[model samples]
Target: MTPYIQVVTTVADRTVAERLAAHLLEQRLAACVQITPCTSWYRWQGAIEQGEEMVCTVKSRRDLFPELCRAVRALHPYEVPEILASPVVDGGESYLHWLEQELRPAKED
Candidate 1:
């Protein structure tokens, strides 16, 4: 798998999603964040619920997942926010290069 990943999280509204996206970009934790309106249905507190939400798809390196999750949780209003990451197995070389350039440099151990 590639070192890149796409982190996804859902917020209650567009405002929250935009705030989260801006914060991630400002912190250099994400190369790009795409926000989309969505309808989510899930089980919460033993009850099935549905709502309108905004999905934030973040393009970032896998190594930054931990920090990214922490930042998201700090700003997210939900008691248990959804922070999921999926490996980017492949992508366009030019786009990947741009992604790397936009993100913070990887730290050395």
Candidate 2:
């Protein structure tokens, strides 16, 4: 398994996405979270639905995926929030290293 990954999830609005992102970063569950505005179409409760959504892309180590999911779920408003993780097959060495560093546990002072 790749050591790096990106977790993807969608929220009803930008504000929710921002909060989740901030929480994830503060908890050290993700190195960085990027929010994007987009339109999504899906079937929910047997009905077709379309709406504006903010996509959150969380970058971090693969080992932190579970914690990241849990954090997102906690802040997410939807009962069933979309949480998906994908491996980063390739990335700049400097960027990958930075990501790992950001997710590292803070040393005791």
Candidate 3:
């Protein structure tokens, strides 16, 4: 079987982060999501800047990434939201299996 994965999305606001978390889980795009509050430091146009943000760590099967990404894009409030996905190289077999099962579409037999 293919690897399960965890995608990390950092949003500019808490409400947007919560909404994205809800949308992904409700649509079965993710098995679980963890929202974290973070102080973001970066450059937007040119100068260095900082802001408050919330990050969502979403767990799912890697195969569902495209659909999951699409869902985030559709529901995201930002003009360009940070959607980052990473491979789950190693983990518990049962947990990975569950991730796959959770991400599988109901329309599939």
Candidate 4:
């Protein structure tokens, strides 16, 4: 497995995406979160639906995936949110090191 991964999820609105991003950063679950607006089409409840959405890309270490999934699910509004992780096959050595550092949990006394 690769040392890093990017977790992607779509939210109904920009506000939701921003909130989720902020929460993840505050929790140190992600090194960075990028939110982008896009149009999406998919089937739900046997019906095809189309809407404007915000896509959130969360960058973090591969080992933190489980926790990242749980965090996104807890903050996501959709009953069946689209959460997927793609491995970073190769990245800048310094950037990868920074990502790993950012995801480390805070030390407790």
Candidate 5:
């Protein structure tokens, strides 16, 4: 798998989503964050529910997942925030390079 990953989370509204995105970008925790409106249906507290939400897709390195999760939890209003990561197995070379450049430098072992 590639060193890259995409983290996803949903917030109650566009404002909160934008704030979360900005925080991640400002902290260099994400190279890019794409926000989009979405309709969600899930079981919460043993009851079926539906809501309009904004999804934030964060592009960053896999190694940053832990820090990213912490950052999201800190700002997310939901008691159980959704923070999921999926590996980027492949991507356009130039685009990947740009993504890497935009993110913070990887820590040395």
Candidate 6:
């Protein structure tokens, strides 16, 4: 099993944020997701741009990152979504275990 980590991505709007979070959690791609509204300023097409955005902080296992990235790319509206991740070195063991279970795909007996 891969270690757990947090993945961060920003969406252009609140509706997209909600939808993406739902899709990730529903598909077991993420254990939890948080959405925060913020203002983004960056360079786009060689020009400075600013806009309101919703940042999605996703938590899941490292092994699922590739799958999660692919999933995000498929549905994301931006030409490039900020898909970044950081490792979780330590945490409450019980909570970590719960995260693992929460993101597990259901099995058929």
What TM-score goes with each of the models? 0.97, 0.92, 0.85, 0.91, 0.98, 0.91
lDDT (0 to 1) per candidate: 0.96, 0.88, 0.84, 0.90, 0.95, 0.89
> Per-residue lDDT of 1-109 in model 4, one digit per residue for the tens?
5578899999999899999999899988899999999999999999999999999999987767888899999999999999999989998889888887788754445
Predicted structure 4, TM vs. truth: 0.91
lDDT of 5 by residue, 42-77 (tens): 999999999999999999999889999999999999
Which parts of model 3 have CA positions greater than 4 angstroms off?
105-109
Steric clash pairs (candidate 4):
none
lDDT of 3 by residue, 43-106 (tens): 7778998888898999987668899999999988778788898888888889777777777654
**Highest TM-score, which number?**
5
> Against the true structure, whose lDDT is highest?
1
Q: Once model 2 is optimally superposed onto the true structure by TM-score, how far is the C-alpha of residue 28 displaced, in angstroms?
A: 1.1
Model 5, C-alpha of 37: deviation from truth (Å)? 0.6
lDDT of 1 by residue, 2-89 (tens): 7999999999999999999999999999999999999999999999999999999999998999999999999999999999999999
| Span of ten consecutive residues with least summed lDDT in model 6 | 100-109
**Clashing residue pairs, candidate 6?**
none
From the highest TM-score down, the ranking of the candidates is 5, 1, 2, 4, 6, 3
Candidate 6: residue 30 Cα off by (Å)? 0.5
Number of clashes recorded per candidate: 0, 0, 0, 0, 0, 0
- lDDT, residue 52, candidate 5: 96
Relative to the true structure, candidate 3 has a C-alpha RMSD (angstroms) of 2.4
lDDT of candidate 2 over 4-97, digit per residue (tens): 8899999999889989998999988888999999999999999999999999999988777777888888889998999999999989989977
